[model samples]
Target: MSTPASTSANQQQTHTPVGLIAFAWTLVGVPLAYGLYNTVKAASALFGG
Candidate 1:
């Protein structure tokens, strides 16, 4: 009765949806963090602190 090996190959999905989202978030977060850091540094310099 174990004659069908094709069922196991087609039953699973190999795509990861969360991993793709995390990767995208990291790509966008790097530049955003740099912008925030520079903004704070500029403010401090303006006040002569």
Candidate 2:
């Protein structure tokens, strides 16, 4: 038996805003870049100085 229309699957899509996505990336990328910079600095110190 087919389901009722009230119980049917939704066809609409939810989208994130571009500004919000950019803000989220900036939030994640800044600390990630900082951590990578620190790791590279430590590795260079260990290998050379």
Q: Once model 2 is optimally superposed onto the true structure by TM-score, how far is the C-alpha of residue 21 displaced, in angstroms?
A: 0.1
Per residue, candidate 1 scores C-alpha lDDT tens digits across 1-49 of: 6767668766876777998989999999999999999999999999977
lDDT of candidates 1 onward, in order: 0.89, 0.91
lDDT value for candidate 1? 0.89
Please give the RMSD to the true structure for each candidate, in Å. 9.0, 3.7
Across 1-49, the per-residue lDDT of candidate 2 in tens digits comes to 9867654365566899999999999999999999999999999999988
> What is the Cα root-mean-square deviation between model 2 and the actual structure?
3.7
